[model samples]
Target: MSDLTGSTDINTANLPIIDYSRIEAFFFEKTAENVAENAKLLRAVNDVGFIYLKNHGITDEKMKQLFDYAKEFFSWPVSEKEKIESCESKFFHGWFSPERTSKTRIADQKEAFDIGDDSNLVRPNQWPADWPEFRTEMNYFFEKCHEIHLVLLGTFAETQGLPKDHFDSFVNEKDHFFRLLHYPATTPDSIGDRLRASPHTDYGTLTLLFNDNSGGLQIRGKDGQWLEVPPIPGYAIINIGDLLSRWFNGSLKSTEHRVVEPPPEWSKLDVEGRLPPRYALAWFGNPNRNAWIEPLSSCITAESPQRFEGVWAGKHVADRIAKLHKDGKAPEVWKDSMYREERPQQQQQQQHAQLPALA
Candidate 1:
């Protein structure tokens, strides 16, 4: 997550709700209607920088199971939870307690657990042996999410006036990350740092978020107002990230967003249970670890030259973690800036084939 400088004012103007049912048509077809869809996508990225995506083909039941596993894991006693605490792990990829993680330079007061594919970036994901269903559901979800991100990349590439596979070479064996985050409920009077996560842009390419009914996610609109991203049933929220912004030469936004206290209307507190905690599963789509995340040459011009240096994707991730983890933790393996280079070339190739270039 990028801790971007932004505003806290509420936006009256609405964010767009997009239907992804036509994604197949747009990614696979070269027709005029598909052209229109591509334009629609570009508009969302330029204007709101985020969209409510429906007809994404993920089942509500599966998402619910994902939540069930999250709740179960978090319900364990402190000692039990300590068995897999992030501070104890070499890669900092396990459970991070509420008060021990900072986002906006302040303790986020929310808990999270991160998982990623086995890679040179760190190591194999650590799964709780007792939670077999958790591993199965999460792995399944990650694979499905990978498919979604590929289509998204194609649309973005096509819209940026590049071949549909313009970004394909850089995306092989991507370092996709899945995280389970929870912001526990507090009485209105007891609310401390109301922002669960402070305003920040993600360091990755695309961020797909699945949230429960309890709403608090907010994004800074172009007008300098923060717009509420209420949870829309059956819709998974999608937003561009800093990597995409550079690729599009900032014509597309890496919108700044944060989780803050929801207005009363958006709150789903129960009188008996008091305030109920909010749970969300975020899938962060990143590029290959060795790929240099520099601005695309096609996107640069006489007026807008490259704005950022090429950051090795793996180093960018480790650097970000070193800054945010309250305990300042990172695996010793992460000390080297270019560890991915040590891996064999063929191992870096993706199991999936590169997407075909658009004609």
Candidate 2:
């Protein structure tokens, strides 16, 4: 396995671009024509941990609408945007100013708004009150991304020699998150040594990311070098995450990646001599809160024994999220809330009675 720690350089790597139309066909039927395409996807992810997916069903017009909504939301006055700040929610589902997020000691230079499954009782989505259209459109886009996520999950299960529906039960509750990210224009000196987004691996099953052509994203290659991931219009960049890697016992990689300033040639400056702002949408796919995350039996072998102990999916993700906040802690309410299982009334009462007090 490649070392996960590294600093990024400007060298651009030629990443593969897979046509998802063929992969979609393979998902429905095992035809010879589309089989190779599926294999390409497996190879790309295993080798580089990232790939650009085209023809994935979401339209360019729809992507543009999402970007427009993000820009409008981020353009709101700081006070207005803070009305739904993440600090207000124990579940971290709301606006996060740049200062509130980081993967390292230096804070990131981007603001984000997070949306989770609306049906999640533990963390109902915190939507901007007045913008009904933003809510409507975001939900619409969220479902569209979920469709693609299902297809990819099925593909992964089949390719990994598990039943095609192996992951279905794990994701039935739709414990996922959608984020609107905006990296504001700023000069190099202003952000010295800091990045738009610090290097880190995602904490979920997989992530489907849509970005405007304004470039910045980079992925760490097996050679431990940072490779530029230029955005192709209408393409969603897909990558594995830590949970998926754990499930497969390191067979699929959850590579470290980050967003840096655009290359000099691609950099466009505004009147104040700052690079152009960049926007992106990311759909973070995760298993249900109650799901048990352990390596599939097939993934453990004589050569590669189980590398991780069993863990509850929700708690694992929540623990990682808590570290991103300034205080480095989740809300006290989150401790008892995330892993609660449904049960008979009497059993529920008994479980609650035995629970530990919140810190």
Candidate 3:
């Protein structure tokens, strides 16, 4: 809980690396030191946009398991990986080879798997053939990430002097997204304007990422320079996103970040031919589809009125993804889910008529 006020200075040329073990004490005891630590959490989120949190209780053994699954999955041949292509699920819960992507302006030489809530909001996931253990492991990791999100959210509420569960209602069992990514190494000479992931802001509330130490991730600092976020053992890199930024009235900025070309240093470990691949797991925590987001009353002031209009979390995220993802569509299954296009006029009218009359 010691103050690292000096560490947060933009001039420090570093992203604030926080010790999160103390953040828990703030919620239970609320001692002056714990409160100070919570303050640091707020300040770092508002200023840095990206942070490395240590001692958050995720063990090395668990991390290894997560990455091992990713390594095994990505180790498959392109044709094998394509067997569960997102098109198969229509809900975007399967693999997305480099050729199937639209997130980059140029073709990204990588592949990924996007998995999340399988409740009524989205279709069921597509399991890779023969890798039955993948589902169990990923679900465990996903739930772990959500548990962390709840802790942080509670900490956020405490910092703002709101009820501990201020954000509780906004999240449900199905309001999360996780993606496993593998970026294949291309020779430094081969990369053109295309990047592994183009510079853009994340679309949800908060992004929690576990990097396997390959180091292509960079955060755009307020100074307008790209700062490399090197791997810190036993820590995950967390960043604010657009929805959270809007809720804070732009106070907590969603720092723009991207994965650039992989460096030669990564080539030393050649598991699949000369292709040196980098892997990272991303967990996106979004609010419920109907949960409204607007700048917090505490954040608005006479000098700084509300800076954004209220928005429904789920719809906004879905819309944004549809625009950025390759093909601009989820799998055909999305049509039956909440993200499906609007109903026809006749159907809509009939549905409305079925509703009970207002008093």
Best-fitting candidate, measured by TM-score? 2
- Write candidate 2's Cα lDDT for 312-350 as tens digits: 676667666765665332222222233434346534543
Output the lDDT of residue 284, model 1: 89
The lDDT per prediction is 0.69, 0.77, 0.71
Candidates, ranked, lDDT = 2, 3, 1
> Which tens-of-lDDT digit does each residue in 176-234 have in candidate 1?
78889888876655454345766677767889999988777888766777877777766
lDDT digits (tens) for residues 84-202 of candidate 3: 88743265578977466664445565678988864445457777877768888888888888888888888776656799788887786456789999887665544455567667787
User: lDDT of candidate 1 vs native?
Assistant: 0.69
- When summed lDDT is taken over every stretch of 10 residues in candidate 2, the lowest stretch is 328-337
Each model's TM-score, in the order given? 0.82, 0.86, 0.83
Clash count for each candidate, listed in order shown: 0, 0, 3
Worst 10 residues of 3 by lDDT: 328-337
Residue 359 in candidate 1 has what lDDT?
Answer: 11
Ranking, TM-score, top scorer first: 2, 3, 1
Question: Considering only N, C-alpha and C atoms within 3 Å, which residue pairs clash in candidate 2?
Answer: none
